[model samples]
Target: MTKRAKNTPRWTAGMACGLAIGIGLGIVLDNIVLGIALALCLGVALAYALPSKDTQA
Candidate 1:
């Protein structure tokens, strides 16, 4: 199996997901601050929760 490079950047997807959820919540709830805060927390949580491909071996 091919191993992932150790230094591969993985934050993009988390950031994008966070931004989408934040924007959606912000628009729906009419609370930009709450949405942003939630997004930031979620993105950080997700980033840490996700495992890098290198560890799959």
Candidate 2:
């Protein structure tokens, strides 16, 4: 029997959430540049905060 590896998501929920919130806030505040900046910062932060699994076992 062959075992299949689990697939990891390219974008985590936290990253997506951060991006959505950033864009929404930027739009409401009427600044597209701010939205992009916020999205980049928040997405990086959120993505970095996530726990990564070690592939080497």
Top candidate when judged by TM-score against the true structure: 1
Question: All candidates: CA RMSD in angstroms?
Answer: 5.7, 7.3
Clashing residue pairs in candidate 1 (N, C-alpha, C atoms within 3 angstroms)? none
Which sections of candidate 2 miss by over 4 Å? Answer: 1-11, 52-57
Which stretches of candidate 1 lie above 4 Å from their native place? 1-9
> How displaced is residue 31 in candidate 1, in Å?
0.8
Residue-level lDDT of model 2, residues 1-57, one tens digit each, is 899755443357657977898999899999989998998788877765654564325
lDDT of each: 0.74, 0.75
**Which pairs, if any, clash in model 2?**
none
